[model samples]
Target: MSSYELALDRRAKEIEWENDTCDQYDYRIAAFCGLAAGVIDALFVGAPGQGALGRLTDKGADALVQKIAVMLWKGDKRSSAGGRPRRAPDTLERAISYLEQAFPVNYDARYAADLRDTGGALSSMAAKNHHLLSLAHSPDLIGLIFSILDQFTGGASFLYKGRVIRLIPVKDARGNKTAYMQGTTFSSKLFCGICNWLGHLASDLCGSSSTRREGKTGRGAGLPIPFYNLLLLMNFGNFDGASFAELAVKVFEEGYDLRHGAAMAVPVMVEECSIKLIWALKRRFYAGKDWSECIPSSKHADLRIMLLVGNAALCLVDAADAAIRAAVSGGSPLTFVLHLNLIAWARLITLIFKELRIRYGAGVDGAFAQYLAAAGLNDAYALRQYYERMNRLDATLEQKLTEFVRETEKEYERFINGVNQSLNPACGTPRQRQEASVAFARRHGAAPERIMETPEQLREWLGGADRQKKR
Candidate 1:
């Protein structure tokens, strides 16, 4: 029985044991009601003290427990009263709670499961299948999830050296949970939030890229706040079912618009298939513990690489995102760069925020402001050289690559140092940077087999492709 149930039983007994039946008020109302809580309190919190109903038959036990739970629920609701002030739980917290309820895992259950296909298949789908709204501010919802996620503090342990992998369950998806240990480091969590926010925004069906511009100003001005606002919204809800595939793709195709000065490129954001592919991979993997084992370390390493490349790709993606705005208006480099750079800057904030959390802890004082503590980009020049070399080695890669250099600042310096060391001692080619770039490109799904061999030759293919699109 829950604490509420124990209280109910005691209250009932107090009413039954009433000596003064002649007068109902004389029986003591407080005595009657307080008994209910006394009886059930031990049941929920597991402190101590049992009520008369403790030894009841199983059926009666069930009934009494349910009744007490109902009363407690009612009391809890009443206690909350008309929207008083309180902090809200976040999506991740709620997700953790869902996992707890579904798995009902405890510290003793600190075990690992295969991560692959673990998402929907294993889940009973009851508690773990709710939509975790990201930025749209569901305070109560957020608060609830956060409360749930709290169950993992010092409770579970994983085999990752001394590291603990707290798996977060998928709310909307049926039978799975994510395997990645929640990187509680400020930087990791912050980046995760950014990803989550991006998801929330993208899932919003009500808006499109057009929201960035909506007004009666010049040819294209206002930056359709509504559209972007809705864009942010759609990203939170699950777009997993087959129908969303067509809808997302169609909408993306319609909204994709990027420009360079006046030179607008048609479909720069790559197909929705790409983003969908990421989610699909997530869906296919992010289950339990086994997923980490199933995916090769090389693939995992490559994703780390992709995260880097993707950030680098963002320079272009940022430009592409800007293109969406540009598509609405005629175009200008200033507006394009302004919007692009602004998002890039947001990415920078996210990056810096993430690195701080990783190096220090998120709980450090004023975590959000930690970027001020980060060293200035002393390695930007080296990174610039790296990029120039990489691009020169394969111009197509110039278009395809994206990197998150902020986090790589130290690494870039280290790489430069190593290169300098290897060169003077034995003597080597300056082209090694270009050679390294080629190797890095090959690591990704780069099938530069024919594409790199002849960019000029592909002009015919590109021409044909454009003609087909136009038709």
Candidate 2:
């Protein structure tokens, strides 16, 4: 009757059949059946991920149907576990029509003996294969078996300890097994590690990677292990201690909750474009040639790739910076830093996409700093870091970017002061404005007095237009 029930029951730990009144085990079988039935019914109504429209893309209601259906048929417990067959006889579209009979979830009766009979059914189907039967008996394999089963039969999300988590089976190249649960929120630390690992995949680990960074094989060859290490450290997406939910909300919300004791916030957007761009870059990078070096043999491409990737990395770093700033500003860097997360997500994805002219991503290292400047992130610390990363990778562009930030910060200070005056009409007034100006100067590594009042003065302190003369 309720949707959560349909999604949450699949995880083995949640269903307490031994003590849950009626046979929970038997009911679980029925739940699986109901899931199957739901998929069948969804053939007309649409299920979660079997189609393009299932998530981000809108390839019609049946977008991923082919992929989902194929995986489901191969996941049959009644088949030998030695390995799945390479193909299936019917298209998933056709199979969904019969889902009601095959995996019906409407009643408790259907699940009772379905999987209980799988071992026997599988052996019969396998021509009495003994080796296959033994692998089927392994407990760890059962979870994978069930997850694949859930993907096709539908109703995969389930509640554990009062939180909802959807089951998604993900695979890296080489067919190594991994899972992703969309909408599964975790603390900043865990998210950071996941971000780092995934980020490495597109930039360093992909097939085309040739050069090495900070030791270890090139980014391409080393991806799986680092990703796994990050995941293991994270205990495979099982985050137990932090309440990142508040952090999540704050990162996305319009204002920080600083009126109490928390810092003020920057705004967040619900819709995002990171994954799309990242994948696009992947296509380009693999196409060959270091697009980032396209400007000339001697010049960095000032490539957008580095800029975008650097921006995304800033999302993680900014959160840390925001926490420190929140203690002072009425707002947390997080409120504003959320922009960085989206940028980080987008950058990781964009880094995957290769630029047309060159490869190795335009030679702009620590890409996000360029993005921060481009996005007009005038925060002193966030800006300085961008220059720092670029200075390490490309001196010419670093000088250019540094000049640009210096000029922009000078302009932005006035604009912000105007906005502040309009919003807070009373108390402190111009005094707070002056203090903010002074603080902005101090943060920029600017001089204390005159630099606070005049943006031009701050620019001069940063070596301004003169910094460009040497170039």
Candidate 3:
């Protein structure tokens, strides 16, 4: 017999019926009742020195645990009268505990299965299927996660690269707090809270200090702010407004210093930021009102086109640079990786342009048209076809990998040449070249200079007879 049964037997023997006239059967009945009562009391109040509910069955103990868990989750503040204050577990601790119970991951079982099947196909497939199923509960999971986050460390903050990015709300002109995402930076000067990713306060989503310095009152000061603010509002706040403007501004205006100040990895960062902005704009487009009114004028549109096209061109330059560096270093061919990256960029550009066309009603500004013409392309439609052909989902991976290299290289050379021609009018016809030369002369305060037949002769002449005197 178990310890309880043995204790009950001893207790039954100790029970005494004290009535003198009582029979042996009556005495036995009294002892039996006393033993039964003792066992029942032990079951109700638990055994002495046993942890929590040691006398209770497993089911009973688990039920009690669940009840306590529910009470804690519900933030029950009840305490015994005249007892010490109720010291409940913290919100994070409770949330984590609840999550563990709700989503029980059997890592040991998974590991054992993986070990048994060396290929791990069965375990991997099972994990993938389970992950897919879990997605259905994403909305609830998100809420729970936010709750946990809110409970810990005060408020909403994105932890990136081991740094906490705390966003402080900004105040507008009327003294009311405007919603903004400001990071904890050393500078006292306020930046566009949302666009401080450049790690400076000069240029961002809202306003720039450069505008104040340049004495530029109208054009560059706050032109993109309204658009970016709208985007930020749509992304993080209530979805109001009918039509949103296209988010094409000068790359430098958006605080991307790709030329003199940028690191080698900046192009990649720019590409990522561009992709993020594109997504935000897309979301705004889908949910908001009609965008016809918010459409930029031809001049602003040209700048925007330049920004987009320039970014696309830079992506090509970056790829070429990577390839050249790899070749020089005798590194393995990163052809597959490069192709995949280009394909993704192509897809993003295609989507952004397609949406812009749908919203704006026709072609992109004269800038894109001129750019295409200079690139020796008769039609911009052909470029669209090129992008679409490469981005075909039905195509095999091998085909994509092959086409990305061939097509991108061809397009890269053409676009780069076109960009060079646009920047340097000397690449154009004689009359156009002469006009560009005249403009350059006027800008540099050059006294009426003639266009020489050869640049070498012009340079030699400009050296003058005074060169010997200097020597």
Candidate 4:
């Protein structure tokens, strides 16, 4: 079969196998798993400062920051007090300080006045929410690009008040400009920039160097949650006279940074794993399904629906908890919104999009399959094999026919030569003998009336003559 036909056949089968139907039981199980996950979220993954999981994630993040700082540290190993080797960043504060000095940037603006003094138009920028406003501080692809760009160009980029602004390089207290991406070649400069970006991120992941050094017990201004900087563009909503962009900044200032974002992911992970595990177990134990068929993959229609239902249930519970808490706190809309698990809602949104894509893809595949069937090309592989076999057989028969024809011509020539010799025993030359033989044959009608009458008859006569001569 042609490659296109083969590909169509493969795709049709794949769609068929993946189109698993979901029943009421599957949905019920999914909802149950989601509710359980929501309970976990409510009990242990609440607002950043008031949740056990949040605190744990915060500590973990601090440890990670310290670890990265130790790896990047290249300062003096000897202690100042004693001439002995000092341990690598024994404390998180020391780690933050070391990284801050190692990879310094010119974008450390603390307030609107700092930007205004530098001729920037971001009036609302502040130290408390500057990480969220700065595009280079994000942990996503946008952040990476801007981080590299800022390092290469010696400028800071910020998205503030629904507008993008770039500020010139700021001079340090010693009046020396901070060098960024210190390298001679492009490749070396790129490497230095990447290292600088990563080191800067580690330095700010927990909190700023100043905040850590001040011995602050609060969740000091850490880096924004991954991709949270994009939320600054959502300036449309008006909750209590505050736009969504403002609210996002407010949430980040209230310790809803990367550590808190990590905490929020716990319940979503639980919901996803719970539904998939339960579905896989049920298929294997109760439904008598094979191991391959029992896999709880998202490609399966049933699993996709189950995940959607599960995530939706989780979001519902999270919204309810946030609403009740907000009501208890005197019906503050911002509080309610802040308490909502944005990660869970995001997961639900992605699940919805995936379900829609799957449905649309199924429809397209069905139409293609029908078209192929109507064209009678569904069995193209078998037809192609049959034609190949017939072609081979025809070639073999033609080769054998050519050999038989050549042999028959040679036998006829021999028979004519024998007749000529017998007709004229006393021969002068071969030409004289052949002429005499022809004259004798015409006069006596000795030759066969039609030598080319039937190929089968000629073959049979030749065979019989050969057998008689041998005997």
Clash count per candidate: 64, 47, 4, 0
lDDT of candidate 3 over 54-148, digit per residue (tens): 22322232343345445544553444442222443233223224423322211111111322223322232232121111111111222223222
Clashing pairs in 4: none
- Lowest lDDT 10-mer window, candidate 3? 130-139
What is the alpha-carbon lDDT for the whole of candidate 4?
0.75
Candidate 2 lDDT by residue in tens digits, 143-175: 223223342233232212222233322332223
Instruction: Give model 3's TM-score versus the native structure.
Output: 0.20
Model 1 residue 260 CA deviation (Å) reads 18
Show where candidate 1 strays beyond 4 Å.
1-302, 316-334, 337-352, 363-367, 370-471
lDDT of 3: 0.33
Worst 10 residues of 4 by lDDT: 376-385
Show model 3 residue runs off by greater than 4 Å: 1-304, 317-347, 350-471
Residue 394, candidate 2: how far off, in angstroms? Answer: 38
Candidate 2 accuracy as TM-score: 0.19
Q: Of the pair 3 and 4, which is ahead by lDDT?
A: 4
Total clashes for model 3: 4
**Candidate 4, which segments miss by more than 4 Å at Cα?**
1-13, 74-86, 116-120, 172-175, 213-215, 361-471
**lDDT of the candidates, in the order given:** 0.32, 0.32, 0.33, 0.75
